[model samples]
Target: MTKCRECGKILPQEQRIDICLDCSRKKIQKRFRDDPELKDVFKKTIEELRKPENVKKMAEDTYRIVNAINEMRDGR
Candidate 1:
């Protein structure tokens, strides 16, 4: 058994998602409905992170995403 990261719900082994299922599903739907480009950016960033030669670029991409999210939050 494990606790969900987002909701802190205790779940059986099979039910344990990286985040709670509810949170994960909500995030998935949100990604599809709004800011779909972020989904692609996350995928590409993960792929880049997996490659040793692209690690620096991965960090740069992550920073860009973080800044973009922050800007959106700040209504900039």
Candidate 2:
């Protein structure tokens, strides 16, 4: 079994990546936090995502996606 390089977590048999998803996510977040430019961009992006208009749009999009999945499952 493959193991995560950073956390030593055993990876699934078919997983091709060296690191587990959780550890990779943490590493990416740490990089964004440590880099000043990336930190600012990430902060701004999060702020934009939190805006009411964006939140509403995201919710609507999620609903549409779920409905689409349901339709597909129902053979529509």
Candidate 3:
């Protein structure tokens, strides 16, 4: 048996999802529907971040962060 990643349930190899089936349907499908406030906030944040100047800044920041991770992995 392997542990389900989301709900920490013990399941047989052939029967396991990252989350159990019940959680999969109820949580993944309906969770966003249940959180209108969070969805609006997420939408507003993404719209702000998608401006041309902000997009470039975000890309540069992500590149620098990934470079730092690779350096650590390579012991540099």
Candidate 4:
């Protein structure tokens, strides 16, 4: 058995889906309706991380991006 990550609802193994089916469906619908660029960015990030030579660069870039995003969120 597994539990929903978001709601913490205990469910049987077959009944449990990643992040719970409801949360996953809502997330998918949200991705389709808004913030579609996030999907592309995630794919690009993964692709970059897969290359050995790009690992360090990707880590640094991710750090910078995360900091910038956090700063923006904090209204810095």
> Largest TM-score belongs to which candidate?
2
Error of 3 at 24 (Å): 0.3
Point out the higher-scoring one by TM-score: 2 or 3: 2
**Candidate 3: regions farther than 4 A off:** 31-76
lDDT of 1 at 49: 69
lDDT over C-alpha atoms for residue 20 of model 1: 53
What value does the lDDT take at residue 36 in candidate 1? 72
For each candidate, what is the lDDT?
A: 0.57, 0.56, 0.49, 0.54
Question: Over 4 Å off in model 2, which ranges?
Answer: 39-76
| Model 3 C-alpha lDDT per residue in residues 1-76, reported as the tens digit of each score | 6665668977556552344544443442343475444445444654765788786444334334334444544773
Go through the candidates in order and give the clash count of each. Answer: 0, 0, 0, 0
lDDT of model 3 at position 67: 40
Sorted by TM-score (best first), the order is: 2, 1, 4, 3
lDDT of 3 at 11: 56
Lowest lDDT sum, 10 consecutive residues, model 3, at 59-68
TM-score of every model versus the real structure: 0.38, 0.46, 0.32, 0.37
Over 4 Å off, model 1: 36-76
lDDT of 1 at 13: 61
**Candidate 1 structure quality by residue, lDDT tens digits, 1-76:** 6776668877556542345546554554565467776677567656766788865444344445555665775784
Which one is best on lDDT? Answer: 1
